[model samples]
Target: MTVTYLLVDGENIDATLGTSILGRRPTPEERPRWDRLLSFARDTWGQPANGLFFLNASNGLPMTFVQALRALGYTPVPLSGTEDQKVVDIAIQRTLDAIADRDDDVMLVSHDGDFLESVEGLLDGERRVGLIAFDEFRNTGFTPLKHRGLQFFDLEHDTHAFNSTLPRLRIIPIEDFDPAQFL
Candidate 1:
């Protein structure tokens, strides 16, 4: 049977949402619905999806969020390290390396470019690889992966993982602009 490893980098997603997209902390209505993301992953490949949420718990474990992740069928991978180390990224990168040896597919839910190398390694005809993020905020470095067959799905649009539409700034097509409506 086919299976997909849905790896989530919560920090990267949250940073992009608050800093690049929203310009402020996301309200409850704007927060992503984790369950919806998991469902989307399962539906994408029509197979069972194992969601793994990575967090930098060097400060302390957020029990509430960890519990929520468990309730939603995601394994919470909290990591710790030295002050300068990026624990979550390290763990996710290592996990990706390990997944490269397996036949199961991968869906990474982060806009960070740090995983580009690992992602590229997984495109060797052994399994399907996918990236999930907001189109406007995703790193341009990942663009080339599309030509190599790495599918991309928008977290909000494709996954519908939020209750309300998020306010994001994206370039609009000149043809899409209606001056009369604004006037």
Candidate 2:
């Protein structure tokens, strides 16, 4: 079977879908959904595959968040750049590169449309590229790729019922960390 690689945009995922879980400091509750997402990926794609989360490297992230992701088998990679950082784009490119030499399936979980080109390249290269994002959020924007014959994977909102589920970031204390200045 071809190896599967998951490229996660942690901030994008949290900011876009976290609203569904309304509450203060909902990290604990989000954990179960997070695990479920991973489990879904594993069951759908298989385990022992690469899972990397792209995070803002310049501003630095709380060790707690990093550790939590690590515990879930996600490799947190820091991208170089501050508020002006293009790390997300770079990170996506890196994912494409990693799968260039092998026959692998690429899964990107984010609502960011900036990755359209990179995703197109993956398709052109004959690699299986799947986009995983919130269904509601995805519909809010227009995706030309969708019409251009791109395949996407929508995560079910019923993450709570998944047997292998992880917590979902329903609410985060952005005021404490000051996400605007931090990321």
- The Cα local distance difference test for each model comes to 0.90, 0.64
Q: Report lDDT (Cα) of residue 87, candidate 2.
A: 81
TM-score, model 1 to reference? 0.92
Query: Candidate 2 overall Cα lDDT vs. reference?
Result: 0.64
Model 1 Cα lDDT, one tens digit per residue, 42-86: 998899999999999999999999999999999999999999999
Question: Compared with the true structure, what per-residue lDDT tens digits does model 2 show for residues 1-183?
Answer: 776687887777666545653333335444335555566566765544567877876766777978987898888887767676678777777777767667777777777777766676666536566777755566334366666545666654433322333334433345545566437
Model 2 misplaced stretches (Cα beyond 4 Å)? 18-32, 139-149, 158-183
State the displacement of the C-alpha of residue 72, model 2, in Å, after optimal TM-score superposition: 1.5
Cα RMSD for predicted model 2: 10.1
